[model samples]
Target: MSISSAAPPKPTQVLPYATKDLHEVYTLGTKLGQGQFATTYLCTHNTTGETYACKSIPKNKLLFKEDYDCVWREIRIMQHLSELPKIVKFHDAYEDSFFVHLVMELCEGGELFDRIVQKGYYSEQEAVKLVKNIVEAVQDCHSLGVMHRDLKPENLVFDTVEDDADLKIVDFGLSVFYKPGEIFSDVVGSPYYVAPEVLNKHYGPEADLWSVGVISYIILSGVPPFWADTEKGIFAQISHGILDFQSEPWPVISDSAKDLIRKMLDRNPGKRFTAHQVLSHPWIVDDNIAPNKPLGV
Candidate 1:
């Protein structure tokens, strides 16, 4: 008897949500940005000549079922939250044999920190406004049963270069849908912004507030509260959850702002301030408290 080789397994579809081919609708242009699994490009509509940002995720990059699921979840989450003014609007999704493309609103103003640096002036009032927008977006996400697992200054982008341009939350790659009281075990999120509960491998939506607190701290002091040379050292510092208020800018920072940060950065998730509470806090609600003095480092 002759031995016969078995047939190769069929490849699974990477995007069940995409029905059309991306090339047929939009012409891909210059590259905008690149991430681990996707490369964002400037794309123009073939028919209307309108411009948009396209995030093209290669199928080959998705080596596992979980990777495909993550991309799917990201698409769905963006679609679900597109109506919110603070979120980057999702236009459509498309797929071919090799790649999945997500078309979204083009934000030309760039990252939050870059815009701040370009302006040449930073103040508590400006930081308060930025935090208010962030917290409000987080509140909306939580209310919609979505948890933005990753929240940081780099993910915040402006729609235009205008001084009054709208700041939008651009990346939702790590976002997930959650039910009340749901707990997640994944240790996900950027260093210096990850919550203590997250490092413990047990956390919820409140972890987002911790990230906002870290961003707010950086905005105020021009430095992260927890800083180290390596990722491991940063994680260790974050796990300790010790905030430096005695540093250069902290003494000059407002008391109410510090209070809010303390509450948001609480090691225990239960004690952390809720999105609503952060929005309702005196510093956020009272404009007089946040001074116009430049907080440049």
Candidate 2:
């Protein structure tokens, strides 16, 4: 299958609470994010006053006949891996002809993409810490047979607290549940982060790891390695397994960081390091490792 040009309207959407009694569990607020298929909002539960993120997608998006089946697929996968910690917490999902509301845990501080934009890129030590936490989270997802088809800096949200900030992975709209020996053929994910096999229409969990590699490269280099002049060129580059690391304006990165990228970006899925393997790599295990040290701190 070739890459599709059709894009969604927004990244997320927010819907009004229609329950009869105005309970605390359904106080809707401002829009958090909007996608082509759905929208998310920050809401406050009536009784507890606790806030949550509600992703409301049209009911039609799930009933087939919709432009993309991704929204429904995401709901299924999220429901399956709802118990994982780092994965976005699923609160409730309901549909009423007009819309489907997926209530999930609220994470403040926005996405890691915002932080990256603010700080440019991260230091090696900082990158390692963040990658470590993310690896642990992905490991959790893999353990539960979930593979996040889209794993980018923007999908990582920060749960900001006073002293301890937690990294939570969100945006499961492209995720899928997998069993051993299953072969996924969907050519999905951001062009910049997609694995080579995905471009060839043969993908699996390793595709997710390829995205991780892109995020890791961004964490260290402050830019993507496989950038192209056009959409077609981007897919072509990804398909041909050409990574532009030597392109100028590079940062002062370590060999370990580069090595990690090389391993994760390997064109052959069989050769790409598993998330667990990446976690155990020497770069993540060196004596300098620190659990909570902020990236580039």
Q: What tens-digit string does per-residue lDDT give for candidate 1 at 188-261?
A: 88887898889898999999999999998888888898889999999888888478999788888899999998
> Candidate 2's residue-wise lDDT over 4-116, tens digit each?
88645542322233443223358889999998778888888887888999988765565333333466567777777777777788877665546667888888867886865
**Candidate 2 Cα deviation (angstroms), residue 32:** 0.8
lDDT of each: 0.89, 0.75
Off by over 4 Å in 1: 1-11
Error of 1 at 213 (Å): 0.4
Best by lDDT: 1
